[model samples]
Target: MDRAGERSPWPWSTVRRVLATGGVMIAIAGKLLAHDPSATITWNREVSRIVYERCASCHHPGGTSFSLMTYQDAQPRAAAIKASVLSRRMPPWGAVKGFGDFRDDKSLTQEQISLVTAWVEGGAPRGNNPNALPPAPKFGEPRREEIPTSGLAVSGDLTIDRPITVDGLWPEHVPPGASMQIVAAWQNGRVEPLLWLYEYNDSYRHPFRFRRAIEIPAGTTIRGVPRDAKIVLMTADDNSWFSRLRALFRKTG
Candidate 1:
């Protein structure tokens, strides 16, 4: 130890001893942490909020999915809930972990997902305060539907003199026989997949909305190919029909 309380470089001969000490400390700390464990997770205080905000939108009546609004509704499905949320099949946001920052991101962090998993494995307790639970989530009403896109469009691919950005596309219309394919995303000259194929499935047919706007640098390029496809780009808030005829026949304000 020096006067500044910093250690000078250890002699090479003592390096092995120092490393061995660190290893032992790390192992002991790991065991201590394991013994302590995380706090017990429960539904009424924790898990319900996660589900109501993410799952109940689709899991409620008149909304095309089963209800998960109440403890009773969800208790029976605890295992499946844990499985789906952990696998990211629920909430349905498809951003690859650590890939991009997004607004309105439905996907939970790993810790949040783990809490749900632990709650289930720990017997899905309702906790001791059911009456104090937050009001049931009201996501099933008529409103803008949730969109599950592959991920945010990224643009660090370009070597630009200035920053660039792209306001996201909210696809409002698709002409029949039209299909769109996102082949790949480019970043710093490296190719990555942000691919999606337009299909007959309802989920695929629905328009995609980025959870937030995307910024495209001046030199970046996102290459996509369309085949016999007619997709009309519109804002997320646009409620207008795609057909020219529909616009023509609509009553004026």
Candidate 2:
């Protein structure tokens, strides 16, 4: 999930713009290392290693967007790279940081980000140890799929039907042959489908943090639905999405 902090709105609409192996140990040098006033930060020693650990998964050939697998590919995209990371727009995990310890959270740390900034700002050097780069990340699971599912309107509202924002949903387990989507009913009485999760995997599951967090005002009616399963909404710990999730589980469990 992307961490919440003050950030100028990313102009990704303006057109701009990895996986870590080795058990998260050195997948990256992590701290961005104590800055060496004279140490050279080159592609081999630092930059490409960072790229492989955090970016290569989706950026590789035949993956999703264009490739960032090589320095050649990443060099030209330096500006866009800096924009996405600094804006916290890429590595799209929707949960806000400092709230939950999400597995595979690809959001870059401040130091890591600083490293990137330095690299891009200083000409993105390709230094020694190109071959020292670790194996790039790869995910065997399907990144996406379309599945038949019911919309939130499909299930009648049980509460007072007043406006309320959707933050999280849970089943504890979505067994084999089980999958679902968590749809959001907007505050304006309009229904817009939010998350459509298929082949439901908990490790990959994340709460939907609204870009513009919707607050359901009293008297505004809305609804939710459960498709082939029990679906519950979380409405606590406004500051921490998953913290609210844990509390929800405690109450129901």
Give me the candidate number with maximum lDDT. 1
The residue-by-residue lDDT of candidate 2 on 136-192, one tens digit each, is 676575476322132122222333244455444434334534444444344456654
User: What TM-score, computed on C-alpha atoms, does each candidate reach?
Assistant: 0.53, 0.46
lDDT of each: 0.56, 0.54
| 133: Cα error in model 1, Å | 1.6
Each candidate's root-mean-square deviation in Å?
Answer: 11.2, 19.3
C-alpha positional error of residue 91 in candidate 1 after TM-score superposition, expressed in Å: 1.5
The TM-score of candidate 2 is 0.46
Model 1, 1-253: lDDT tens per residue? 7689988688766988989999999999989875454766778888888877777777787776888887888889999988988767666654444443335666687877988899999998888967758788665356775452322222122122223333333333334333444322344676433334333223334444445555444333444434234333222233333332232222211
